[model samples]
Target: MKKVFQLILIIFSILNSAQQSEIFKLKNYRISVLNDSIQETSGLNFFSEKLYTFNDSGNPAELYEIDKKTGKILKILKVKAENKDWEALTNDGENFYIGDFGNNAGIRQDLKIFKIPFKNNQLQNDSLKIISFYYPEQQDFTPKNISTDFDLESMIYLNGKLHIFTKEWASKSTTHYTLDPDNFEKQAAQKIETFKTGFMISDAYYFEKKLFVVGYTKKTEVFLMIFNESNSGIFFKNNPWKLYLGSALSIGQIEGIAVDETGIYISGEKFYSPIGNTKPYFYFIPKEKLKF
Candidate 1:
């Protein structure tokens, strides 16, 4: 009986090591400190060869274009809409969409996304569209700060629709939902798929038929997940290859991800916890390094 127990313990240790080995460290990463104006930067998007980012709640309704190399604010565009918890940014080649649905507590009913048109690399303040939506599954209007699954922070514009991924703190899983971009009516988002991520999904990026999600666990462990797209605008149906990139202590509460032909870019806001404080920083991972 003692020999059998010893053998089982050895097998368990090996399996645990194998799982830990799958987690790659972000050793070859660059950290660029953002300007003080964008200390609470929440979203990132690459449009027309420019990198765009914005602050979350309590900040101005504006967009900032930062120098990717130095993290310096190059220009600021004053948005005509309110910035009530703008958490995600994405573009459909012509217009930019800003997600104002930063529901940390599942009590907000005014979840909205601002659609702004741009011409000559400048925002046309005359034409602004507001897209309001709600989840039909959520019935409770009570506020539960960190115990609700209705909070959202990730979104993408795909196939003429806005795809939203919920930041479910209750189940640690993300639900995929789609909303009409053109319709101004208060539409109910159609839940398409749900994946057990085991971590909150803060932001999402779709590139080369692959979907990449960036998030962190409560323990401050940051992770990146890559899923292969099986069909047009459908990636949750496939299993994702999850990799523990690093810790939020070093990565600073990652909230945004944007990919281009060069590589992947991530941004983190200033994070404070009982453990310590992480400064607001932007990190770049080259395409070659992610080949592993």
Candidate 2:
């Protein structure tokens, strides 16, 4: 009986070690600290050969164009809208979509996305479109507050529709939902699929037929997922390359991800954890360095 118990202990330790070994330490090159005005940077997007970002709740409703090399604020474009938890940014070549659906409490009924038109590399204020949507599966409006699966933060524009990924704090998974961009009325989001990602998906980006998601766990464990597209909206059909990219203790609270032809860009807000305090900063991972 003693020998059998020892053998079981050895097996358990080996499995734990294997899982720990999967955690990869990323060589994060800190470009610079974000501007003082845009401290709570929530989402990032590359458009018109420039990087654009915005602050989350409690900040002014403005879009900031950042210098890619220095992380400095080059331009600030004010949008005529409310910043009720702006979480994700994506552009459809001509129009930029701002997701105002960062429902950490899971009880918000006013989930919306703002569509602003841009022409000649400038933002036009006359054609502001508001898209209201709701999840068809959410039956309860009760506030779960960081413990609900209805909270969403990541989004991408694909095939003339907007794809949203939920930040499920309770279930540690993400649900994919599609919304038509042409529809302005309150619409029902079509649930497509769910991926069990064990991390709260904070931002999403689609590049070269691949979908990338960046997020972190409550314990500060950070992760990045890359999915090869099998269809337009079908992302979970193939298993994603789940890379455990160190911990938020060293990387801060990762909230945004953007991929360009060169490599991946990541940003994190100021985070306070039991391990240590982390300042808001931007990081770049070169293309050649992000090997599976």
Candidate 2 per-residue lDDT, tens place, 23-90, comes to 55653577877777877899899987799999999999999998888878998899999998999999
lDDT of 1: 0.86
Worst 10 residues of 1 by lDDT: 9-18
What number of backbone clashes does candidate 1 have, counting pairs of residues 3 or more apart or in separate chains? Answer: 0
Per-model TM values vs. the true structure? 0.91, 0.91
Candidate 1 local Cα displacement, residue 166, angstroms: 0.5
lDDT of 2 at 39: 71
Superposed on all Cα atoms, model 1 deviates from the true structure by an RMSD in Å of 6.1
Residue pairs with backbone overlap in model 1: none
> Could you tell me the lDDT of residue 73 within candidate 2?
90
